[model samples]
Target chain A: MSLASRELPSVAATMAPPRSPADTPAGAISGPSWLNNLRAMLAKELLLEWRNLSRLGSVALFGAVTLVLFSFVAPPQAGARRMATAGFLVLALLLSSTLSLSESFRKETHHRALTGLLLVPVAPSAIFIAKAFANFFQLVLLAPVLIPVALVLFSVDLTATSGVSYPLLQLLAVWALASAGLAAPGTLYAAMTSDLRGRDVVLPLLFFPLVVPVLLAAVKATALVLSGDAMGQLGSWNLLLLIFAVVHGTLGTVLFGYAVEES
Target chain B: MRGKFQWEHAVLLLALVLLTVGTYIGLAVAPPERHMGDVQRIMYVHVPTAWIAMLSLTVAFVAAIGSLWSGKHKWDAAVVGSTETGVVLTGLLLSQGMIWARATWGVWWDWDVRLTTSLVMFILFAGVLALRASVDSAERRASWSAVAIIVAYADVPLVYFCVRWWRSLHQVQSTPETVDAAMMLPLRINAFGMLFLATWFIVRRARLELAQRQVEETTLPERRSVEEVQHA
Candidate 1:
């Protein structure tokens, strides 16, 4: 057989060349699954926050320090002490919320990973809801740390009042409602302002003003609950919170899409 | 020549003249409250300021939706201009509110839900304007501020509802469902008047800024941007 014929003899036996398209992964694990994607995004955000150990530490420390500072400003009387306690807790919530606003989405933006997160199929509102939940979690953890100091220093009445539930429940509700108020707009604005030069300064400028309604409602509601004032007023405060939640929640849901697009 | 000054400019000047007269009328022509005398003069500024703030936000909300859908720079300009004006008017209203509260409530400030929420609305827009100012890229600034406009617009109802939901020192004066004829006339007049003034101001500012930006872009050397584009 000639050299060319010898080389060609295997043509009948050999397989055709594999096409590039066929070789490509047919069912390869490209990215996370639906549930896993959401969880991973949320978990990644939380982990990034945790790694910044100093931010949370400062927030917790500030709440405690502020509680102690406000205690000194409180008078010895029962009503005054209660008022001071309520004021201090509300202020603590505001400060933490402010901190949350400034730092809420910093990790994602800093890592330049937000674009990747956005590429995921998860909804934008979920990101907002998850961030808000994270903020609420931080506040919940910080509250207990500050509560004992608040009680000890300010003599806040933590004992169950006649009509009001345990002081803890009332305070918790206040924090949750206020947290939602602060976080909704805070997250939205942070997302919007993340690309700005001075994001820290920009964040609070947008945050504190929009939080006025929630702060007022929270302060009054917390004050009423703490004072064991007319139970009727508590009902009103709840209604106020419901309004804020609905308005801001709807707003967040609607605008978050645009924000994510802008981001 | 683009008619040197457009009809809109003339209309704006006329509106300003009318607004000055309205201020005088509200402060001097209107009867003083029997209980809350001379200091009631503050209402002229307070009422007008509040009216303008809400009007500005309404414009912003419309402009936001417009820009988001149309992608026209004019709508974005409207959003920026109105938001800036809204924030300024809200701030003025807040300061006026503080003065009113000091006179009536015997305190300079109170944690009233309505007042606080209004302040929040002011801050929301302030942040918005800051967000707009801080960015050099027009597209990013417009798109981002548009997001802010929608977010802030959503808070309007929350601010409005705050007065009614919580026991607040600030009273809920007017609502579509609840307005009385006695208060409605002046309130309607003031509301419409303020709307006109806000639109006028927004258009005027937007035109000037847009023109300035156009001039700046045209004047920049082409080679610099072309080189930057190539490097990118």
Candidate 2:
């Protein structure tokens, strides 16, 4: 909308500026081309994340260490073991998502780095989608590395008996949905907060609440899956995940443009 | 123009009087429910406070949208002020809910969907306010807080729907058909009265806050001049 220039044109005459020269890309901006753009943006986002290797490494290490510590505290019973597996899985997802999503817009805001990105031919929605995708991928990648350690520490069997296949998929779905929910608004707020004093504190303050629904759903669904409850229940969890993802994705896309412009 | 009371102020005062009378009527005059007993009286306050909480969040969302669309500091301030009021009202409602629960449900808390969602809403409100306080720059704080407000608020209905969609211990809505004539009058009156009170609070606080900021802006140059003279 900002790309449109006004000359007292009629409403019908007013049109948004095209990011791609092709008219086809204009419509595709909502579909596959956006997906491709999202993938590329995600790749760039991942590279940006990898640049902060120390932070990422510490977070992963902290997650593993936390699981190891929790194992000792949990009651040494079969039911407790069942509970521990879910708890550790949730712990890993929470650690990775919160840590990464909290910093989702860090690179963009540092030294007005985001302004340079905005000058590129990318759409604002694309930027959000890309950031969300990258964060989700990173959380996923970070999770598997902890899974084996968590299983050993929590005494979980990752076999067919574990029945984690459906749950794992469900958990992954929740994680991706939760990451998008967090990162979408988070990236925008981080950009705004980073420009203010004491960003060290403000970032988390802005992020935690915006993602509570995601956190609640993710925690519940993941816990259910890890507990290997009735398969029938997964349908409901998946529905919740779908609703969360769609709502966040739509809200994020529509509003990211405003945040970027204001930032 | 500035010295005289406006019609809006008169309306607010009338609403306050009505609220006081309504509370007296609710607590003193209304017949107690056979099931909930005297504790049911709390519904007059509890239900209204919960309504205000919901209203506050909605206003915050609207303010965020206004700020984003118009880029006004006043809109941002209203959003922040409404959010604070919402958080306080939510805390009150939660306490009242707990008291009512003890009298009615035997347990102080049940983790019911509605109650849990309300708790989550308060957490979101508190977090946003904390973020607003920690940031030093007015412009950056306003912009960022507005973004958070909008995003969080947009999820509110989803949360409500999610709770409603699930089977939970929390009782669903009590329709007009279900409610007796005695409870309906106070419920309706207090609901409107709370809206009036909430609007007055948000407007008055927003104006006072804006005036204070303007005072600071106007004084900055004078303060700078004093410092220069002292150095000289």
| Every model's TM-score | 0.77, 0.82
Q: Across residues B1-232, which tens digit of lDDT does each residue of candidate 2 receive?
A: 3797755586688678778877888888889877667887898888889988898988988898888778887998798778888988898888887887776778898666677678778887787888777754456567667877877787777676665555444566332245677776787788878888787778777777687667767867777678558534
Per-residue error at A87 for model 1, in Å?
1.6
Best by TM-score: 2
Report the C-alpha lDDT of model 1 over B1-232, residue by residue, as the tens digit.
Answer: 3658666666666666666766666655666655676776666556767877887889889999899777788888788788888887888888988988888889998767657678777777777787778876666677778877787777767766765555444454331243334433444456556667777778878887688667756776675487458534
User: What is the TM-score of model 2 when looking only at chain B?
Assistant: 0.83
> What 10-residue stretch in candidate 2 chain B is worst by lDDT?
B168-177
Per-residue lDDT tens digits for candidate 1, residues A18-135, read 2354453221233323334345446645654565556777888877887777777778797678776766777877776667566665545543445444543345665666666676
How well is each residue in A1-263 modelled by candidate 2, as lDDT tens digits?
11111211221121234456763443245775565556555656665555556666777787787777778787889778766576566656665656666565654554444554455435678777776666666666666667677767776654434445655566566656655655555655655565555776766665665555565566666666666655556567657766777777787777776666633
Question: Fnat per model, in the order given?
Answer: 0.73, 0.48
DockQ, Cα level, model 1: 0.57
DockQ of each: 0.57, 0.40
